[model samples]
Target: MECCREPSCRKRGRWRWRWRRQSGSGVNAEEEHGIKKIILIGTPNVGKSMLFHRLTGIYATISNYPGTTVEVFRGRGSFENQLFEVIDTPGMYSLLPLTEEERVTRALLLAEHPEVLIHVIDARNLEKMLSLTLQLLEAELPVILVVNMMDEAETLGIDIDLAQLEKDLGIPVVATAASKGWGIELLRKRIAEYVRKHGVRKGVG
Candidate 1:
């Protein structure tokens, strides 16, 4: 498993997200780091920060739709023997900029050029939340949908066919109960695999 530590491979997975550093490729270390960013974007109260904490193992400040992530939070997650910088952007409902926070989050997305954009959504609210997902896909960005709060959905008898959703969206979909630590390992695996599949060995600088 080139992506993970040998010992952790059993639990982590075989493939990993890798950012190549070649001296003559004109790609400096800082820009290479930029290529390693994993961003989380979605509407408010969808367990975005919970998923972020599970991925990064860091405590993030949570609120009830504060709507201003002007001061974003980031932490590192380790999988496949490599570390990924994960970010929690402010809540945004559409690609069209409306509020200041949405504009901030939108600008950051274009500026950073992240390796993977994980869109966290409440599994029970898939219909309303999916429009933003479609918009992200229309932008031709690499996006993975995280169907979070499955435990709650299950309690409410809400069933989501993840495989079908993935096939229909033409992107990766991972169901997670971030608060309960479900599907996190698989989430990590998918993140690594997505980066490896999409990223070409070239300069991001």
Candidate 2:
């Protein structure tokens, strides 16, 4: 019988899946209750590094691509009145590693098993950026999608329906102008919620 149609399989897997979701949430609370380690990820030049600095107040070297600097940075941030160890990873287009940096980025994602994985992307290029978002979900990472460069999107007459996007992805989607300090707090709150709801300490995924 097909897995979806199998009663016994559903009975066995449903609670296990629910329990895994709770595990992720628990990990978030664990951090609040004194846990650390969150990782930020995205494609190149999408503002992942900038967001890291904004959230952590520590600057990492930033530059343009094609002779651009692609390296990960580590920092710290607090949300929901709790501290966290935050890591900003190198830009990666996909998990099926293509470039050296992409391979490195994928390795980090697999090994770190971060409590929260923030996927920062260019809001103007949502169509293109979402490919990575889908891939993240495929990897079973606890991912939150951040649409960075909202200001630019507005200037270009590109309106992103964040609610609709969230519905499509079944994940929290936040629009941010990271450089201008917009949406950072809300982003923090959502991150905290996801962490509290999904982080393994809470018995979530």
Candidate 3:
């Protein structure tokens, strides 16, 4: 039985996705509800939705391989009195888009200019995923890397040297097993810190 046939199933890959901007926010993220926008970005099936669900308590299970997210979901989460408007974007491989979903995500980044981009990636596929991370940095977008699915990676005898990665990227990189709830709090802490450092609202001219 193909589970994706159902209306509620998340496996429809790169179809029926829509990008919408919120209304009534004239100010930057830090001022409005102290709402920092944390947009999730990565190639398909890198555990983006799983991290999204873990962060927001929203249920959105995505598929594997050609496993693009079919829709974009937004939700809010808070940590230590700081609130965030978390955005789960359609899965895209790189800053340079090849698909509609990729285009929409890249366009959203330029238009919305979110405070921080959480680029979730599989721990097992770090080398391939780092290219996008480099692109985000090149584009001067504030980004945080979430190295997810560590449990599976460990089982495969794959150990990532995160500190070395941080040194190389010049940005914060977090590890997690979103399915197991490991490294989530640390991710939140890093996010809160990133927002506090970078999400400061500028004075209106």
Indicate which candidate wins on lDDT.
Answer: 1
lDDT of 3 by residue, 1-205 (tens): 1222444323232322321133332434224433566789998898888888888776332332133444557766777678666778888987778887888787667655577889989999999988888888888888899999999999999989999999988899999999999999999999889888876432210
Which residue ranges in model 1 land beyond 4 Å of their true spot? 1-35, 59-69, 200-205
Rank candidates, lDDT, best first. Answer: 1, 3, 2
Task: Give the alpha-carbon lDDT of every model.
Answer: 0.75, 0.72, 0.74
TM-score of 2: 0.75
Q: How high a TM-score does candidate 3 get? A: 0.77
lDDT of 2 by residue, 55-99 (tens): 888623222222335555656677887677577877888889898
lDDT of 1 by residue, 69-150 (tens): 3677766676776557677888899989898878877876775567789999999899999999999999987799999999
| Alpha carbon lDDT at 114, candidate 3 | 73
Candidate 2 overall lDDT versus native:
0.72
Query: Where's the lowest-lDDT run of ten residues in candidate 3?
Result: 11-20
